[model samples]
Target: MISLLLVVGVLVAMFVAFNIGGSTTGPAFGPAVGAGAISKPVAAGLMGVFFFLGAWTLGRNVVTKLGSELVVDTGVFTLTTSITVLFFIGVALLVGNVFGVPASTSMTAVGAIAGLGLAGGVLDFAVMGEIVVWWVVSPIVGFWVSLIVGRYVYDRLDELVAMERSEGPLFTVDRSGSVPVPRVHRTTNRRELAGTATVVGIGCLMAFSSGTSNIANAVAPLVGSGNLAMNPAIALGGLAVTVGAFTIARRTLETMGSDITELPLTAAIVVAAVSSTLVVFLSALGIPASFVIIATMSVVGLGWGRATRRVPAPAVVTGDGESDDPLREGTDTDATEVPNPSALFDPLTTARIVLMQNVVPVVATVGAYLTFRYVPIFGF
Candidate 1:
């Protein structure tokens, strides 16, 4: 019976990991893919590799926090209870995927476990409080940093990073030596190659951040239950994430790369760097960072700042013996310089994305609480 229960728990854990992969890959690699710096398959491959590296390292800290520290007693994480918690996380993330929005895997996972802890009467208020504080703080930090970058540095960076994809393959094999070495295509300019590399490198960074924060979301329950050791469970979860990266992640890639917002290449890079750094720092402190929320807020901030760029405040408006009507007094060129409010993303679409991300976690938290509180089979 124990063996069968363990198997069931592992399967459920993998289901959660799979959804994590699909939901995270978009935010990690969307900019690179959208910029034609790399193809979707290459992006997926990089995501799998970097994600594992992160999970095997700093990710352990986060796993320990979520699996054992959030609840007063790890004993509450029986195999049945673990499976139930994972089911709520997996289903909630899948709903986000269906709507083409990347959900917060960390938030959903934490919510489920928090619910279980509360229902089982073993909730750790201090740990939960700390996590909640970081969750609130990180997104605000990401937004402000991104906003400053957009307002002061975006235009210059965009011009410097402009990349035009050449007509053919980016690289070709040169078999002149004993080993076949890859060489950049002659048609690709040095600047273009450098820009592409930078974009791809940032994508890898985002993937690593995702792994650090998200790995625990998949396997923490089982790890806390003592049904599976940490290393083996992390490896299994990484494998499931890899599978998801190669498959269902494709749809999410499309949504993020193009549909999420009109994110310029420079803006995307800025957001990725800011959000990824925040997640990694929080994960190192044993907190489950809300990557989706941080990234989305970063996007909005970047756009808002860019749209509000300070053009010449119009000589007429300065009340210098000029006409009172600023619009009529300014040159036609000045009149055409008016900033459009919707320069970066559609308000309605952004609202929908934000709403769904928050709703999924809430649903998971509420559902887990009700199940553990009312269902005798969970042994809560």
Candidate 2:
């Protein structure tokens, strides 16, 4: 029976780790893949390597905090509670995948632990309050920062692209007296901004941060059991989880990058940079926060702000080539042609995505809480 229970616990841990990989990979790789900055296979390879580094190096701190420091006794983490938490989080992630939404690993993991703690009569109200406060604040902060930066950067690029388009291509002549070849005048402003340097830098930082920040999710439960030391377990778990995420996260990345927004390379870069930095900062402080929530909110807010300023209303063309819609007669059609708001910033989709992401954490947390409250009544 003891051996059977150990197998069950290991299986549960593996399931949770797989889900973490799927959910976490999107934030690390979505921008590069979606923006055509890197080929899919290359992105996957880099993601695997950097994610391991992140998890192995910085993941230990987060693991320690979530596993042991937040609660009173690790002994309370029985196989039953571990299985229950695993089930709740697994179900939540499956639901999100079904609906084509990206759920958050950090949120689900922390919520489950908190719920279990509450049910076990180990509720740390003060610590819970701090976690909640950060959860609420991080995304808002990320959104505003992204919004401002995205606008400035995108506008400048737009102006530069316009300039390049207006001035025709340059020409060069060969010494052999052959026909003059058209020299490609690369737009330094827009094109250079999204070049290799920028992409590589962002990719490295995001992968590192992802690995570092997500250590808490996979190893927290094990860490909670006082029989184990926190650092080694966290390092091993982080490496394993990062590998899993790099392999399986592609599906989730497709959901976030294409389904949520038609992210241009520059905009995606900005969002990743800002969101990853925020998550990393929180992780360094040993605070449990949601990278999915942060990245999604930042991307949506940036897209929304850009859409409002640039997206024009629909119009009907008249016989004489005039617009029949009075409201849109003189509006800018160049910006409106792409259907930016409708394609990328649909309210229903945004709400659904947010709901799916939050549900896993919420349900898992609540279930753990209830179990903790009622387990004694069953005479366990």
Candidate 3:
């Protein structure tokens, strides 16, 4: 029975990891893939590589926090209890996937674990408070930082970063010498090649960020239970994530790439950079960052900043500007009429997306609490 329960716990943990891979890959690589900067297979390969690097390095700190520090007593993470928490996390991931939104894997995992701690009377309020505070603060920081960038710097960067794909292949094999050398295609300019590299690099960064924080969500429960060691747990979770990146991530990639097609590649890159940085920083502090919310708020902030630039001086107070029209198109203005590609942000759709992201985590929190507190099988 003990062996069976341990196997069950590990399987559930893998399920959580698999769903996490599917959920995170879209946000990490969608922009590059959508822009034709990289293929989905290449994106998946990068995700696996960078994710493992992150998990092996900074990810261990987060694992320690989740598997041990969140609850006052690690003994609470019995095989049965671990399975219960992992199940809630997996369900949360499923909910996010079903809704075509990237779920807050870190938030849901922490919520489920917190539920166990609360039910068992071992909850650490101070630790939880600190994490909750960072969660609130990080997204706000990402928003404001992105807003500032969009309002002031995005245009300059947009002009500099040319992400337009050219006709034919980006590289060609030159077989003139004894050894074949890959050379840049004649049709592809330097700026375009640079842009492609930038998009793919940012995608790798996002994957690393996801690894630093998300690995804990999958394996923390099992590790806490003492049935699995940290290294093995991380390896197992990473493998499951890689599998997910190759399989279920396909649909998520399409959703993020096509469904939110209006968002310019520059804006996506900006959001990814800002959010991924924050996530990595928080993970260093052993805090689980919610990338979905951070990225969403960053999108809204970037769009709002870009939109407000067109408002007349008097429009700030009287609300008489063209900015009131949320669905307004085109980037022309009296100033320079610079090509503002990120003016397509829609507030209504963004609000709905934010609402759903929050709802999934909240549901997981409540469901975990109810299950652990009342369910006789868990024996909390």
Candidate 4:
């Protein structure tokens, strides 16, 4: 019966990992697909590979932290408790996919683990406090950094990355010699090729970052229960993510790809790079990072910065390019101009989105805490 329960727990963990794959693949490869740089299969394949790399390397530290340090008593994570915790995570994922709202799996998992600790009478306040603090801090930092970028250098950067794909396939295989080599098409210019490559490369980077942060969500509870070792758990979790990427990520890919294509390629790259880097940094320090929150904040910062810019009008001249006051009633042609209000960002919409983003984690946290405290389903 013990072995059977452990097997069931691993299956539940895999179910959570499957959901992670489906949700994360879209954000990682959306820009690449939007730019027509790569196909869904390629994106899915790269998502699996880089995610595995991230899990195999930086993701382990987070597993250890979550499985060992969050609770004061590491022994609290019995097989039954682990399964109960994973059940909560799997429910959160289901809610996210079914409702079209993207939430932080890390946040949900941490919340469950914390709840389990709290109920067991051996919770570690210090580790829990630190994780919560970073959860608030990361999103704010992302917003401010992106805001500065949007305000000062957005247009210039936009021009710098003004990319348009030319006609025909980017490369063709030639079997003229003993080996085949890829030959670039004549119509595909250098800039277009470079832009495509950059977009696809950034997608891979996002995949790596997601893998680093998300692997712990799936396997940490089981590892805590001593039902599985670290590497095998990671391997199972990574494989589950891959399964999700290939099978369930198609619809999200279309949706996110379309939305991202409406923006400038550079903007997409900037947002992805900034958000993914933050997640990776947090994951390296044994923290479960929230990818959705950071990405949303970064996007909001970019748009808000660009929209509220004040443009300076040049001076008016009669016959030559001379300094003439246009503010004067006689020569108000091009002098100091009134700044137009670029109130493009909708406050209500942003507020609602942000609010909605918090809902899954909040529910997961409060629900897990309450369930663990009152319910006897897990024998805790």
Candidate 5:
């Protein structure tokens, strides 16, 4: 019976870990993938490696916090608590999957723990308070940081393009004969700023942060029961999670990246940077925060900022009798050209997508909880 219980617990942990990978890989790799900076398979491969590294190196702190520190003076963590927490996380992941919302593993895990603690007379308000504070602050900070950086960086790039265009191409056009001839500049400066290098760096950082923040989801329960040492647990858990993410994370990524926000390269990179930073910080502080929520919110905020900037005003005639509305007489004569590609997917659709992302986890959690709760044959 003891062996059976341990097996069951480990299985549950694996399931939770798989869900974490599915939900997290999108945020880690979506920007790079959407930007065409890397292929999906390559991103997945890189994510698997960095995720393992992050989990092994930084995930330990989050696992300790979840497994041992949330509740106070509890001699033995009941199987009931572990099962309950697992059920909640599973439910949350299911919800995210169904609605296309990238549910935070950290949020669901903490919520489950809090719920069980409340039921078991082990609720720690102070700890809960701190977690709540960070939850609110992390996303907000990410949003503003992303907004500032995205606007500034993109604006600079636009200025450079404008300047280059104004320079008359450094060539001469001749129409002296029946055929028009154009002369091209033999010498041109090639700016080699290593943009790809920066992208690779960000990708690495995002992958590492994802692995570290997600370890708690898969290994915390085992670690909590003192059945597995941290190092070995992380190694095994990281491997399993990486494989699961690479295999099944695409569905969640589509829901978050395509359905929620039509992320351009700039927005995607900013979101990735901010989300990765927030998750790494939380992991260091021994807080289990949701990477999905953090990343999702960051993307949404960036999109929203861009959208507001693009709100259309009433069309007016200029002094030269030309329309300022690009849609009317733009160089590209496509009538359906959307100013903000992100606006193509609105909040309503995004909400629905996010709803799908979250629904699967909720159902799974509820089912697991009920299975453990009502099945007397198992002798829970």
Candidate 6:
């Protein structure tokens, strides 16, 4: 009983969801795969599984919010209108990826939907306000939690999770037994195995959180159109995600794990755990959280916290309480110079970085709002 328009709408939704998978796979598994703790196939497989689990359970609430609650009247979501709304959201993703901004899918989806609702005079301010509140608060919460972990616990965690890859293959298939059994290499110690497991496990957790947050963005429009039921929509979106994970995520994994930043295995694991857990919690509450911002803030917080500990004092005062060794203070130091740890976090640099990220969502929201309201092409 599916109409042609309905089928086309579903295809568009799948396209968006597929991209969601590709975008999410990088953050979810790039570290583990990049660090050689796991292979790309393994990472992609895990992302598909965990993403489904998350979407099947906690992600449903978000779907409800987007499909039914955001607009007081579901009548606004005609098949054509739904496609139009989703198109804009997809464009936001394109803009982000092209411009190196990696925009928040949650924010863009909401903005486009809100725009449609506003144009139709059915936008729910209460729901929009609630979503906005979480958007504002969640990052702050992540920063503080990460700040704590960065300061008091990161060192101990690092000490415990220090990763040292063993020589030879970590495990090899042995045909000596009745069935193929994986045997640890003679060089692979228990500690090294545990370290590898930790990294891969955190990657899986991040994948789960990504599913929870992103599933709704992929299929909410289809669900709103009444062409698909919730469960079917979720399954379709999950399948698209799997396709994205296997195909496009390969490149993203390489970029994040190798090109963007070089991080120690322990630090990567910690950041993965903190950011993913926060995202899962938010998705459970039907709020779409930003993994990009959360993870970035976590890295910053963890680094800043670690840096502040045992910071070199501001004034290395002599017995006369004067500045110590003026020549060494501001002059270009030798390559071997041990700089003060107090220089660990630059306030201006950090502030600018965070501010720049915030600007993308703001621009997206305004753009979507204006486009939906004023564009006569949508036939709203």
Q: For each candidate, what is the lDDT?
A: 0.85, 0.67, 0.83, 0.82, 0.65, 0.78
In candidate 4, which residue pairs clash? 326-331, 326-332
209-316, model 6: which lDDT tens digit per residue? 888888888888778878789999999999999999999988988886321134666667777788888889888888877777777777777676666554333445
Model 1 C-alpha lDDT per residue in residues 163-263, reported as the tens digit of each score: 98888878889999999999999998888998989889988998899889999999999999888999998899999999999998998788774343236
Worst 10 residues of 2 by lDDT: 162-171
lDDT of 4 by residue, 7-119 (tens): 89999999989988988888889888766778888889999999999999999988988999998788878887888889888888788666656767888899888878877
Q: What is every candidate's alpha-carbon RMSD to the true fold?
A: 4.1, 8.3, 6.2, 3.7, 10.6, 5.9
Instruction: Tell me how candidate 5 scores on lDDT.
Output: 0.65
Misplaced by over 4 Å in model 3 are: 174-181, 257-262, 310-344
lDDT of 2 at 88: 71
Per model, how many backbone clashes are there?
A: 0, 5, 0, 2, 30, 0
Per-candidate TM-scores read 0.90, 0.75, 0.88, 0.90, 0.72, 0.87
Q: Which regions in candidate 5 have their CA more than 4 angstroms from the true location?
A: 34-36, 74-76, 157-193, 250-261, 308-345, 350-380
Q: State residue 290's C-alpha deviation in candidate 6, in Å.
A: 1.5
Q: Which stretches of candidate 1 lie over 4 Å from their true place?
A: 254-262, 313-338, 342-344
- Could you give me the TM-score of model 4 versus the true structure? 0.90
Q: What is the C-alpha lDDT profile of model 5 across 113-176, one tens digit per residue?
A: 5554554456578887987898779878877765555444544643332211122233456789
Cα error, residue 74 of model 5, in Å, equals 4.1
Q: Candidate 1 has which clashing residue pairs, if any?
A: none
State the displacement of the C-alpha of residue 324, model 3, in Å, after optimal TM-score superposition.
Answer: 27
Please name the candidate that would achieve the greatest lDDT relative to the true structure: 1
Tens-place lDDT per residue, model 3, 204-275, is 999999999999999998898889999999999999999999999998787663232336778888888998
